[model samples]
Structures are given as structure tokens and as C-alpha cells.
Target: MAKYNKVVLAYSGGLDTSIIIPWLKENYGCEVICVAGNVGQDAELDGLEERALKTGASKLYIEDIQDEFVNDFVFPTLKAGAKYENYLLGTSFARPPIAKRIVEIAKKEGADAICHGCTGKGNDQVRFELTIKALAPEMPIIAPWRTWELKSRDEEIDYAIAHDVPIKITRETNYSKDMNLWHLSHEGLDLEDPANEPQYAKEGFLEMGVAPEQAPDKPTYITLSFEKGIPVALDGEKMDGVTMIKTLNKLGGENGIGLLDIVENRLVGMKSRGVYETPGGTILYHAHEVLETICLDKMTQHYKQKLALEFADLVYNGQWYTPLREAMSAFVDKTQETVTGEVKLKLYKGNIINAGVTSPYTLYDEEVATFGEDEVYNQADSAGFINLFGLPIKVKALLDQKREQK
Candidate 1:
């Protein structure tokens, strides 16, 4: 008597997911349908269909969501300047869209349950399950790490060998990873110790780019154009979403632009260390930030800064499908109406130096801002304006003086 007759599993051609297909069938007597979302993990998708079927899956649906990921998830978060604990929300924001598609495929196949490979100790389990709960409440969710007797990835590897399930990763090179168009994150292995500096070279784990020290000596300049707070062109060339990310990824990676090693607090109240590489995303966030300073007014920009922190916290904790995130996005989109502009930057080693920035919506007026002789700004106007602005302080000082005399 099977509990679930049909189950949809979020499948990557990786160790955990590869084993889960057979496990689901054996334990629950269910037909398994696997869904893989392609968010720009280039080489990770090879022979996925064959692999899924070989492992007992009835079918595999590989969805290409790179454009939607960038436009809907990446850009909006960028527009808000959202960075979780100073780390870009690469893996965090990525979970929602992928899970949304998983839910869609499950509905199409009339699946009785949804399953994922996220561990109980990690943040991704909460992310994946919360998305399922929001979009398809009736569908039951399965987490193997919560139920399976296997203790660690090493035990899982032994199980895989026993079951004749093929995997490229050996225990020696085993590092948990999540990759998408915006960023790639690495965890586990030697990274378990917070004191350990990542052995990126020995592990051969850097997929995005080189270390900053190994970068080329010379600097490279690039001109980026934005329309309505979205990047439209690079160095005077128009590009589509995926192509733009690919182009900037090459430039930023070669220049050693984006890499971070941090011990972060997870959604499930655990502390974990990981290495995150977000080459192009680092550039886009910085460039958009400078452009907004020129384009947006003082109050809007400062207020958005506060909201950006809140936005980052929400996305990092996997509340993407909630109304709060939707409301935050509304404010971000409205602020981006005049964020059209161009910015030129010099990329040298790990530094992104701002060369130039311009926008038709720029509020900067040379006549009003000049240090030299200017016709518009009257220097004498400061006296009356400062007095009026400081009237509260002046009154307080007088009252304090009278109290002191008494």
C-alpha cells in the first residue's frame, strides 16, 4: 500500500537526486517524474534525461528559465540593491522560480507529492518546501534527508555504488554546490571549519573564474547602458538576458571581480560556511548603485536603501512567494522608472573603478554644484536657510542656558 502514487522530484544529475529516484519507487511504490530547471549551469545538464530514466524516473522535464530568472528575480533584487549579509542572493532567490516550475510540472502530471534533495541542516529545504506550500498547498512534500537513515554524503556514495548509480564526484572532491546564471556557491568538505581558508586550487572548485592575484596585470574598460533600471547593453552592444550575463561573466571572471568566503546564519538556525562566486552580478550591482545616486532623489534613494536590507533578508530566508516580497517589489519597480543611464567602469584585478556615469534623469546640476564661479547658486542664501533649518536647536540651546543660570 503506497502512500503516494505519483511523485515529482526536483532532479539535478547530481549524487543526492540520482539516488532519490530509485529510493522513492522502492519505498513508496510511486511513479517518479523529474524536473530540472536550467538557470545557466552550462555543463551540468549533460545526459540528464538518460540518467533520470536509468534511475527509475518515468520522465524528465528540463525547463530553460534563464531569461525569466534574470529579468524577474535577478534584476528586481539588483534594482533594490538587495544583498543578504553582504553576499548576493544567488542561491536563495534562485530557489523560488525553480520551485515554481516544479509545482507547474507536478500539476501537469497530477503528482501526489513533490520531493527535493535539500538536507535538513541547510536553508534550501525550507526554501523548496515553502514554495510548494505557497503555490500548491494540497501537494505533499518529501525531504529524504529528514527521513533517510543515511548519515552523510559518504554513506550516500556507498549506497550509490551498491545500487550501480553513477556519479562524477568522489568523496575526495565532494563539495556541495548550487549554480545559476547569477552565482555559484560551494559548501562542505574542508569548508566545514570556519578557520580554514578555502583550498580552491587544490580542490579544483572555481568554475566561474580565477583568483584576484592570478588576474591579468592590465586593466579593462567597459561601458554599460541601462534602461528602466535593467541592463540593456554592454560596451555599446545590445544583448539578450542570458548573453549579457555570459558576456559580463567572462569579463568579470577574468578580472577576478566577484568571490566571497563567509560563515552565514541559515534559515533553520544553523551557522554554515560557503564560498560564493558571483562575477557578473557584482559588477551589475555596483554599476546600478552609482547610476541610481545620479538618477534618484535623496529621499527615494535613502528610503530604498532601508527597504533593500529588508528585501535581502526576505529573499535569503526563502519568503519569495509571499505578499511581503511582492509589496517590496512594487516599491522597487516604481523607483526604477527614471533609472535609465550609462556607466563606464575600469576593471583591474579585483577592483571596479567608476570611470564615468550619466543619465537623462540625472538630478545633478553643474550650475548649482560648482565650486568655482556659478551664476545660479547664491552663497548668501545659506545664512537665512541655516537659521530656519536649525530653529529647534537654537530654541533648545536658549532654554538650556536659562536652566543652567537658575
Candidate 2:
């Protein structure tokens, strides 16, 4: 019931946001400023400004954040090797930065409140509000789905049609989606039924990429070079983060790679099925793993795997602002000190094969590891090492022999 003279909304020009602008204006009598963040959704952003204006938004702001999306958000999570229950945290990683930009725009525009089209039954509501609360504690968050009378996507469509909001969606193809440079996620519709097998070939609903079976027969080889855990080049061609993502996406998608379908547990106590397309991210995850194998010691690699699971959970649950996440980031960064290397991958029909990997600081010493004679490693030394390593086993065997005699 808080009064607001103006509100800035995180608008995507989708059906939900299209209706939200007029609803906010009519219900709260506040001027609405729509802000759209472009984090490599490609042509989905075309004509967004005019669309927002037609939907009754007084002002519209669209910002290009592709590089920042990859560098500040995606790479950090990638370096940490975070994945949410075997699925990469693609959509989860992009939310915090988008919400941060929403707060920044709200403050600049002198708005008392910020809004989003996220529903009450989703994780995005928590992600958006948490970012707002962390960045600007006093700024009020107006979540229409939680408070409004509008119930379903069908009702929202009706409202948009009645208001002449220029919506491109219809009831037949109603699947909630979120897209970024890393991945595209599809939810709702037939996917909600767990028994239903997802149709990846469907043109209008699923993201336009390749299916594994439909991918090219010939494998495409790619090499990713990294510096201090950040990807710096592709196949000896130096490129920025945005360009690197674009290049890899093309390579990975061509091979029909990076499609994930799962029933995920939402933070709001609901189980939802989502199909994700993360072509570039799939390549990066595999390439990074290949590099880590050469650079990280056995214990560091094992312990970092444990941290990655926790990090993924925190991000998925919208705990991006917590101290534990920062501490974990520090630990992840430390392990990446020698993660500088090139990982060669062979992409073929949805499989990313680790072709070759090399690092300047690699712990893999070929000379000492050779089965043949090597000056650095003496064969006789293995006898002493085996005795020390098997001390506990030897003691247990002796105790068992003594017990049998008793």
C-alpha cells in the first residue's frame, strides 16, 4: 500500500511486462519507466523501445551488457565450476547483474520503487528482490504477480489484447523463457507435465539450435586459451569475453551440443521442468575442466569440486549477496592461479571431447611419469613408498593374524 510517484520496472516487452506497465499506472497512479537489459538475447531485442512505449511505459531504457554478463557473472561462476544438480547455472548467473542494473536505473531516474514481471512461484522473484535489497535497502519492490488480480498467461494475453499492447505471443505457444549469452531456458506449457517428452525440434517454443541427431557429421575442433582463469583467446586469435562467447556458441551449436532438460526444485517450493540450451557454456565448462586437470593438484581439484556444488546451490537460491559466496569466490580464485592454459576440444554431435590440453604450470611431468627409465624417478624408491603408503593395511593384517592365533 506504499505510495509511489514513479516506478522503474525490469521490462522484457513480453506479455507479462506489457500488461504490467498499464496495470501499475492504473492501480498505483504512478508513472512507469521500463528498463530492458540486453545480455546477448540476440534479435529478441529488436524494436523493444517502441514496444514498451506502446504498452504505456512513459520512458524506456535498453542497455547492452553482453560483455559484463560474461565477464562479471558467467566467468566467475565458470571458474568456480558451479552447476546446479548436473545442469549449468546459466539463467541463475544472469539474474543478479540484470537486477543490479535495474536498481542503478531506478536510482538514476529518481524512482521510489522498482518492479519486475517475475511470478510468485518462481526463483526470479527472489533473485530480483534480493539484488534490490542488497544494493538499495530502502527502495521498495513492487512485484505485480504476487499482489495483482491477474492469474494466468491467458488472462495476461486477454489484458494485452484489450489494451492493444502489441503482443507477439498466443495461448498455443505459451512457454516462459529466459535467454542470455550463456543459455536459453524454456519452461511452462507441456514441459510442466513431467511425463511429457520435450520436443526440441519444435520451432516456435524451443530455442533455435541443433539437436544432437541433427548436428553435422564432421567434428569441429576449437582451442580456448585462458589467463588467470578467464578465457582470453580462441584458436590463437585474441578476443574479448563477448567475442569469445559468440565464437564458441557458433562452434558448439553447429555440433548440436548443450541441451539440458530437468525437473528443478525452485526456491519458492515448487518443482518445475525446464529445457535449457547452453551451447557456449557447455564448451567452456568442458574446456575449463581439461585445463584444471593439468594445472590443479589432486587435493585442490577434489576440494574445489565440493565447493562448486555449494556455490551452485547458493546462486540457484539467490544468495548472491551473502558472505559465504564471497569467501567461496576467494577460494575458487586461488585455485585458478595456475589455470592458465589452452584446452583443445572436439565438438561432434553433442559431445565435447578433450582433444588436448597444456599449461605453463602443469604438474604433469612426462619424464618422471614415463614407465621406462628416468633419471628423476628411481624404480627402487617405490619399495619404500609402498611400505609407507600401506602401513595401515599392514597393521590391520598383522592384528587379524594375531587374533586368529588367540
Candidate 3:
């Protein structure tokens, strides 16, 4: 008897997923429906419909969710200043919107189960499954990597070959990657060994941009305008969220602005190294941070910085649908109410230099901060303020002195 009547698989048309369609049909005797979410992976979608059908899939749904991804997922994380150990949480937050769309497709198709190609040892499996559980609590979830006969990518390649499944990579060229409008991440292969420096000059090693050494000699300066923490314009020209990010990606990529190499602690209790290229995101984060310096008060800024770490962890661990994340985002949105400003930056060979920043709601009073001649801030008044601020320290020192005399 068939285990499932129908199954909706989150398909990427990659090696693992290409083989999964046939695997599901052969093993479970189920009709496999593939869902590929388009979150800005450009060339990756080419001929995807044909590829899905050729691999024994009954149908394919390529959901265009780029606008939702950037505005709903990326911007909230950006406003929260959530960066997981220097990773902009690019792939971290991207999973929810994709998985949510998959769940919707599953419901629409009346599928018996939802399946994904995520491996058991990685964070992505947790991400996909968590979103599924949150959205469709009763829906059966299938993880092929956990129960399949294939143990490694090499074995998967063999399975693909035996099934005549077309694959885009070979043993020597396979580097696990995830790409969207926000960023591109490269892992596996040479990156598994932290000691090995990435072969950036090698063909296909870098797809988003060139290495920093190969960047243009002259610096590139660009201006960004923000309205309530959301970027609205580039170089004084109004733009939609998608267009602004796309424009920045080109400008930042040309200057080699955003390339990160880190061995970060994954949520699955292990450390893994990966290289990321987040050109537009890098510029946006920097510009927003600079704007906040003049807009947000010291206490709020310090407290938000502490909260940002927690926010980053939640996103990294795939807790996007939880109430805590929603609460934090609400708080972050409140903080951004006055974060309207413009910032100019100089991009020079992977370095982002702050040129200028301005905000109408800026709390900086030049008259109170000037060193030349400042009547607004009474110099003598600081003596009393400092005394009061250091009262606890002074009292502690006095008590220690009295004890020493005894």
C-alpha cells in the first residue's frame, strides 16, 4: 500500500532534490509536487519547470516571493540590527518565507506530507521543519537525509547518475550554496577545512563579485536615504525596496564591499565555516547604523544593542514564527520611528568608510558639544554631575580605606 497519496517537496532542482522526486515515487508511491520559491535567485530558476517535470514530478510551483522576502523578512531583521556572529542572517531569515509558501502549496494541493532536501546535521533542516510545524501542525514532514540509504553527497551523486537525474555539479566542483536577493553563501568542499584559504581567483569560486584585490583602484562614494529605518532612496533618487537593494548590490559588488569568511557556531551544536557575499545588505546595515547614532538616545541604543544579539540568535535558530520574535520586532519598530536620515559612505576595496550622516530628528546640539567656545553647556556644572555619577565608586573607595586603617 502507498504511504502517502500526494507529497509536496521543497525542490531547488539541485542534486539532492532532483533525485528526491523519483525517490519519493519509488519508495512511497506518492504523487510528488515540487515547490521552488523564488526569493531572488536569478539564474537558478531558468528552465526549472522543465527540470521538475523531467524528474518525474507531477507539477511544479515556482512562487515569486522576492518582495515579501525583502520587506517582511529582511527589513525586520535589518531594523533589529540582528547579525549572528557577523553573519547578516542572510540564509537564516530567508527560510521562513520560503517554507511558509511551501506549506501554503501543500495545503492547496491536499498533499499528505511535505518534504525537503535539508540534511540532518545542518541548521536548515531545523529551519524548514520548524516553519512547517508552526504553520501546519498536523502535516506529516519527511526528511530524506535522516532515513535515506544515501549517506553523503558523493553517494547522492551516484544515486542521481543511476536514476539519470541531471545535476549541475561534479565531485570536484560541488560547493553547497544558497542564494537570494540578500546574499550568497558558499560552504562544503575546500571551505570545510578552516586552514585552507578560499581559492577566490578560481573559476566559479565567486559568483556575486570579484575578490577585494581585484576591485577598482578608485573609491566609490554613494549616498543612502532612510525613512523611519527603511531605505527609500539611493543618491537622492527614490526607489522601491527591491530596486534599491539591487542597485546597491551592483555598486557594492564593484567595490568589493561585502565578503565575510567566518567559522561560526551553528545551531546544531557544531561549528562550520562558510563564505558570504552580502553586498547590498552590508551597505544598508552600515547606513542604518550610522543614522541611528544621531537619531536614537544613548540608553535606547545601548539596550537595543544587547537585544540585537538575542534577536540574531532567534533568527539563526529558526524561531521566526514565535511570539517572542514578534514582540522584539514590535519593539524594534518603535525605536525606528525617529530613525529618518541620510548617510554617505565611501566604498574602497571591501572597506566602508563613513563620509557624512544627517537626521532631522538629530539630538546632537553643536552648541553644547563645541570645544572652541560653548556657552550653552556650563563647564562648571559638569563637576557636580561627575561627582554624582561617580558617587558609588567614591563610596566604595572610602570604605576600603577605612578597612585598611583597621
Candidate 4:
């Protein structure tokens, strides 16, 4: 067997990772250093450090990466208006940054291999491994679910019980969850069968939004201030990206703002149903669109929409380190140069109503758009413009008619 002197495991303090510490010790006889990343998994990090240490980890690295996540990863996607099939790519973009941090810590600690608790069938294993391949291709990746004898979640639970590793999961609430600043996604459980409807009443399952019934009767007003395409404030208060999202998430969640249920195609070629809570992200996307209406020109906005889709795919597929993503970022950054403005929104019962938008660089001219009269745009000029624009379509239709007559 190839020997590993030490290994850095992407530890979440979850059931799988809780057991992996002992499993690695017993099987490979290698010292395990646990690394737990904060990607907006709020309560998931509570007691994580203590638990990892108690579970026989030689060392632990707890990294607070929320700001970097929102600014570096989340904002760029928001700028692109990228959502994977109407559901925001919340968990999709979080993998690369976490992997980058892991590689950094591994090198500092001189670990021989990096390990993760991700399963063989899941998309995360691919996300985690691909990031490592892109960043540190030389390091060995120790995937327990792929190599170990533990096959089922039940068996893993049994191992946890026998080993006395502290865990929060149970058969009733065994749904797999991944939460972060962007959104919270829930899978497994009854979600495995597409026919079964999710039981929303379950505790610790959907923590982000209020049960639609519990929401307030009145609508809430929110104002987002943007400077060069990045959100700089909420309701006129200057704040960082992390704080802005946190504040909006509270308001949006209270109003039952962001809740998406969809069956999406994974990168590994399988359809999966996920219940997502993206309170702040939903607000941000809407506000960004409102600002873009006033800020971006017609040609730039339309072309960037296509670019945004490609950028979203790259982030979802764990291709964050590639040159194309950087190139896309450059293009997005240029479009956002004039994306400075404020968007007023009315949040009412899970609906976001765009109130008004104002920007110094606005292209909307009242004189040109007025129905009664206009100075800049002559109505007679459109006859020539339409003739040129429709020439190709007219030619195609004429040819089709001629062919039908024949």
C-alpha cells in the first residue's frame, strides 16, 4: 500500500467526515489534519473545531471565507445573471475557493494527501477533485466513499455508533444539505423519489425562509446601492458584500422571499431535485437586473446575457481556475463599469416588485421615448431602419412562398 504520512481532510464535522477521521487513522495509519471552511454554512460550523479535535484529528484549520466567497465568487455570478435552469448556482461556485484554501493549508502543513467525505455518486466529489486537479495536480486525493468498504449511509451510521463519533444525522432527517452565503440546498430523504413531496415542517431542514404562512401581511421596502456593479450598501447604509447579503437575507427570509424547488441536470449526467433557500441571492439578482435596465446599453446587455450563461456554467462545472472564466470576468467587469445606481424594491409575499431605478449613465431619454412628441427620435426615420432590418426576413419568406408555388 502507498503510505501517507499525513493527510488534510475537508472536514465539515458532518456524519461522514466525523467517521472519516477514525477510519483514516485505523486504515491508513496516517495523521489526519481537519480543515473546515466557512462558505456561509451558518450553524454547521458550531462546535466544529472542538468536535474535530475530540475525534482524533492531529490538528484543525477553521477558515472564515464568507467575504471572499460573496465578493470573489458570488458577485461575479450575480453580475452575469447566471442561474442553472432558473435555480441559482449557489453550491456550484463555492467548491473552487474552498479547494484553493485547502491546497494552501496542505502545503503549509506539509500534508501528503488531501481527503474529502464526498461520495462517488454525488456532484461534489467531482467538484472537489477537479479543483484539486486544477490547482495542485501533484497531490494525492484520498476519497473514502470511493475506496472504503462503507457502502451505505446506514453502514456509515453504524460505523459512527461503534466508534462513538458525535453526529447530528438520523434516519428521519438524513437528507444531505450544503449551505453557504449564497444559498442552502437540501437533497436525499424523500427527495430521492421525485414523486414524493417534501415535508417542510421538519426542523433544521429549511432554516433560511419563513413558512409562507408565517410571513407578514404587509410588504417590505428595500433599497440596494450599487457602485460599479458591486453592491455597496442596503437601504443607504454602507456595508461590505457579506454584511449586505446577511442583512437582505434576514429581510427577504422574513418576507418569505427566496424559495426554489427544481429538478436540475448535474454535470455528471443525472437529474436531481433540490429545495434551495436563496433569500439574499434572489434579491441581488432582481436588483442587479433593475440596475442593468438603466446602466447597460442594448447591445452590451444582450451580448453579456449570453456570456453570463457561459460564466455560470463554468462556475457550476468547477472550471473556476481556467483562463476562460478569467476572460469572462474581464468582460463582465467592463460591462459593470457603468453599473452604478440604486434599485428600490418592494418585497411582498415571495414576490419582488421593482419600484424604481436611477443611474447617472442611464440611456433612457424621456424626449425620445415620449408618445406625444419627441425631438431626438424622428418617427419617419424608422421606415428606412425597419426596411433594412427586415430585408433578410422578407427575402427568406419570399423564397419560401415561391418554393411552395412550385
Candidate 5:
């Protein structure tokens, strides 16, 4: 009656997943191998190994992938200027690398199936399952939410208590949260009702930063440099992906730079309301856009803008490992060839203000564009150019005049 001899479960020491360990063993009669990927969840990862094994997991694998996450996934998504409904693709894109590692560990541990704690109503279930399907199609997926008898979080709590499984969440104060290096998203509870304003003043409401009103009075200024659209340095100091993001997180969080409260359309044919705190990501996105204005050609910039919409959708829909995403990334990489520049920005109370930008690839020429009479440009040439440019409009107007006379 057991479907899998061993299952590799994508384990986070959270309420839902904690109980899932016991549920899987009871229902499936299989050994559960827990794998927790570290994508910069900070305090969320503390004592996860002990918790996994303590709660019926045969073994636990804690993999450090923060550097790879920022360098490979976050930077590329940033370069594409991809935003899922004007918010950073933080949680959306973070799932792929996590899922990728789960497949790897599953193979290493000879797991016949991969499992996750994602609920049926949530997008994450699709994200994790789709990526698993892409990488290792034969490996079965065990989504407990879709199959289990636990109807609600309250039910889950009751089950956990019955099974003697330890968890931090309580029915009264449970708010669903997903955290990574780029962002921390808060949902469920009061957020379910769109009318209820998010309690920003509350301790757990925002994990990354303070409220905009509570930010310091003085604005913070910093310069960021990019090479091939990837952020390379912060404030004139060169840093690797992890350090740059970490440094920006502290600076941007202090200034309350990135926060968005949105009710977004989920792929599961539902609308979900959540507050996302993406301090560092917001800063990086602003800086990248500013640099792109100078570095990229007008046509390429316009096309890429359109492409960014598709890119954002793909990432949001868990198509990160698909051929379309790969092709789009190639196009994005080619466009970034000239996207090397320095952008200065002012961060003040949740606002990212552009101070200045300079790039070797800037197409703007002072000699040609200056209002002060330029020797390099002949002003009289514009008369003929405008006449030719407006010829179609002029002909159309004449035709309309003749029709009116008739």
C-alpha cells in the first residue's frame, strides 16, 4: 500500500510542513528524507535539522545556496526587469532553485517521490510541483494539502497536537509568511479580507523593515554600479552577489525603501492579498532601470519592456526551467551587453529617488541635443526631415478635405 519507498520532502520547519512529516509516515508508510534549502531565510532556518529529525524525518539535509540564489537566479531576474504585477519576483522565482535542489537530493537519496507542504489554494504548490515535473518527470509528487484530510489551519493544529508534533504557529496568531534574501511576504489572517488594512505597526507584519513613517528623517544616498546589467558594486565598493544584497537589505530596510500591499491574481484562478517587503530588491530594480535608460538602444529598450511582461509571467507561473524562459534569458543577456553603468539614488521613507546616472554606452550626445546652437547639428535640416516625416499625415488631411468638399 506504500507508493514510495523513500520520499524527499521539501521541508521548512513551519507549521504546515512540521505536521506533514507525521502525516506522510502515517498515511504512506514511507521513510521521509527532509531537505531544507537555505535561500537566505536568516532566523527561519535555525535548528531546522533537529526539528526535522525530531518530528519523524529519517534524515535532514540543510543545503546552503544563498550565494547561488542571488548570483544566478535573483541577478538574472533583476536584469530582465521582471516584476510580477509591479512587485519583485521574490517568492515566485525563489521556488525554482529550491525545487531544483529537492530533485537533486531526491536522486542522491534514491527517493521515488518528492513532497511539499504547499496548500492547494496557493501558487507555491504549482511552483514546486511544476519545477519537479520539469527536472524529473518520473519522480512522483506528494502534495499533502491536495490529498490530506486537514481541512483548515485549525484542523492542522489539532492534528499536530494529536500527533505531538511541535510547531510555532498558533490558530489565533497564524499569518502565512515566506522569506528569502530578496523579500519576505506576509499573507493569510487579516490579509484575507481586502478591507482590513495591514497592521504595519505590529511586530510580525513586516519582517524585513520598519514602517515608512518610522524611518529616519535623513535620506540615505548610495551609488550602484552594474556590469552587463548585473549589479557589481555598492557605494564604490565591489561586492559579490550575497554581500551586495545583504548590505542593501540593511540600508534599504532602515530607510523603509521596499514595501507593497497588493491583491494579485493567482494562477490557481484566485486573488490573494499580501504585503511584500523587498527593500534591497526594490533598490536594485530602480538602479537597473535607470542604468538601462542610458545603456540600451531605444528600440531594444522598448522591445525588452514588452518582453519583461512575459518574463514576469513565466517566473510567476513557475515556468523558470522552460525553453521559453531560457530563450528569453538569452535575448535579455544580449540586450545587457551595453548595460554597464553607475546609478546614484536617494532612499527616503519608502521612496527610491534617482539622483544621477552615467554610462559609457549612453546614446545621448550633448553636442547634438544641446539647446544652445550646436555646430555638430544643422538646425535647418529638421525642416525637410519633418516635411518627409509628416507626408503621410498631410496626404490624409488633403483626402479628408476633398471628401468634405464633395
Candidate 6:
């Protein structure tokens, strides 16, 4: 008896997904429809349809969700300033939109169940399944890694070889990697051991950018314009969101601007070490932060900073579809109304330096802030303000002094 009449698998044509097409067919005895959401993993999609069909998929639907990804997922999170333990939530937020698209395709195809190649122990499983559950509550999810006998990547490779499923990676060079327009992450292999340093100089290890040491000696300056917290232009030229990111990626990568090495706590309750290259994303984050400093008021900015922490946790835990995330996004959107600005940055090796920033809504009053002869600010009023502010401290100290004297 077949468990499902048809299954829509979230296919990336990676090593795990390449073999899954055959595995699903063999085990479920059902037609497999593959859905590959294109969130700007450029060359990774090359010949993906052919590979999926060759491995026994009924058909492949490649959805181009890049613009939606940037506008909906990336920008919203950027506005929130969400960073999961300094990890820009690159892979975290990318999952929701991809999974949402998968659900759409599954409904369109009338597939009885949805499938994904995410492993049992990783965060991606939770991310994919959560989105699926949120969107289509009744639909079943087939996670082969949880049920199948293939215990390791080595076994998966062997299974791929035995099944004649074409895979791009070999055993010697098999590193678990996830790439998109925002970033490229490297894990597994030497990276699994926290004590071992990543081999950035290795020929195939880095795809997005060079090692910081390999970057040019000179600094590169560029201007970025933002409207309502979303990047709108690069180097004084108006550009679409996609073009702006791509251009920044090229420039940031060449200058070695964004390389992160961290041992992060995964949602599955285990610590994982990975090296992430997010040249363009890093640049954007820095520039946006610079713009907000002059634009946002002190209290609102401080409150948003606290909110950003919770926002990061939600995104990292695959709670993108939850009400809390939606509410926080609404709050973030409200804060971004005055975030329109231009930021000038100098990119040096593995560093982003703010050259200048300006906004029509800037609250920085030089007359009030200047140390020398500021006419706008009333210096005499600070005496009353300070006395009022320090009254609680003075009362507490007086009580303590009386207790000591007694």
C-alpha cells in the first residue's frame, strides 16, 4: 500500500536531495514532484530539472522567488536588526519563503504529502516542517533522514552511487554547504570539530569571496541609498533590490568585507561550528545601522534594540509564521518610516567603516549637540533636570549614611 499518492519534495539537487528522488519513489511507491525554490543560488540550479527527472521525478518546478525573498524576508528582518548570536539570520529566514513556495507547489500539484532532504538533527528540518504545518495543517511531511537507514553522509554517498543518482560532490570534498544571494555557509568536515580552523585558502572551500588576507591592500568606497530601511541604490545609481545586492556582493567579496566564524547554538539544542561568508549582507547591515543612528530617537532606538533580540530568536527557531513574528515585523515597519537615507562606506579587508551618512529625517541637531556655544539647547535647565534625576540616588545614599552613623 502506498503511503502517499504523490509527494512534492523540496529539491535543491544537492547530494542529499539528488538521492532522495529515487529513495522516495522506492519506499513510498508514489509519483515524486520536485520543487526547487530559487532564492538566488545561481549556478546550483543548473541542470537541476534534468537531474531530478533522471533520478525519477515526475516533473520539476523551479520557482524564482529572489525578489520576494529580498523584499519580504530579508528587508523585514533587516529592519528589525535581528541577528541570532551575531549570525545575520541568513539561512534562518531563507527557509520560510522557500518552504512557503514548496507548499504552494504541493497544493497546485495536489500532492498528498510534502518532503524535504533536511536531516533529522539539523534546524532546517524544523524550519521546513513548521512552514508546511502552518500553511497546510492536514498535509503530511516525509522526512527520509528520520526514517531511512542511511545514518551518515558517507552512507548517503554510497546509496547515491548504488542508485546511480548523479551528485556534484565527492566523498573527499563533501562539506555540508548552503548558498544563496545573501550568504554562503560551510559546515561538516573539518568545521565539525571546533578546535580545527577552517581552510579558507583551500581551492574549493570558498565560493563567494576570498580570504581576508588575500584582499586588496587599498580601501574601496561606495555609497548606498535606503528608503524606509530597504536598500534602493548603489554608488549613487538607482537599482532594484536584486541588482543592488549582487553589485555589493561583488564589491564586498573582492574587498573581503564579510567573513564570520562562529560556534553557534542550533535550534536542535546542540552547538555547531560553521564559517559564513556574507559579504553583501554584512555591508548592508553596517550601512543600515549607521543610517538609523541619526534618524531614530533614543528611546525608540533602544526599545527596538531589545525587540531585535526576540525577533532574532523567533527567526532562528523557524517561528517565522507565528503571530509574534508578524507583530514584531509590524513594529519594525513602523520604525523604518523615517529610515530613508544615504550611507557612504569604506570597505577594507574584513571591515566596514562608515564614511558618512545623511537623511532628510535626521534628528541630529548640531546646534543643540555642539560643545561650544550651542544656542538651541538650554544648558541652565540641565541643573533642574539633573537634580530631579539624581533625587532617588541621593535619598538612597542618605538612608545608607544614617544607618552607618547609627
lDDT of each: 0.91, 0.88, 0.93, 0.88, 0.91, 0.92
lDDT of 5 by residue, 231-283 (tens): 89998999999989989999999998889999999999989998899999999
Q: Write the per-residue lDDT of candidate 3 for residues 360-386, one digit (tens) a residue.
A: 999888887888896777889989999
lDDT of 6 by residue, 1-406 (tens): 3489899999999988889988988888899999999999999999999999999999999999999999899989998999999999889989999999999988988899999999988999999989999999999988889999999999999999999999999888888999998999988987889889888877778888888888899999999999999999998799988888889899999988788999999999989998999999999999999999999999999999999999999999999999999999999999999999999999988789889999999999888788998668888899999999999999999999999999
Candidate 1 wrong stretches, greater than 4 Å: 200-203, 394-406
TM per prediction:
0.96, 0.95, 0.98, 0.96, 0.97, 0.98
Tell me the TM-score of model 6. Answer: 0.98
Cα misplacement distance, residue 103 of candidate 3 (Å)? 0.9
What's the lDDT for residue 218 in model 3? 97
Q: How many backbone clashes does candidate 4 have?
A: 0
- For model 6 the local lDDT of residue 379 reads 81
Best by TM-score: 3
lDDT of 4 by residue, 55-123 (tens): 899988999998888888889888888887888888888888898899999999999999999988777
Ranked by TM-score, the better of candidates 2 and 6 is 6
Cα lDDT tens digits for candidate 2, 181-253: 8888988888889899888665554454688887888898888999978899999999999888887888887
In terms of lDDT, the poorest run of 10 residues in model 1 is 198-207
Give the CA lDDT, 0 to 100, for residue 314 in model 4: 84
Q: Which scores higher on TM-score, 2 or 3?
A: 3
Off by over 4 Å in 2: 204-208, 393-406
RMSD of 6: 1.2
Question: Candidate 1, overall lDDT?
Answer: 0.91
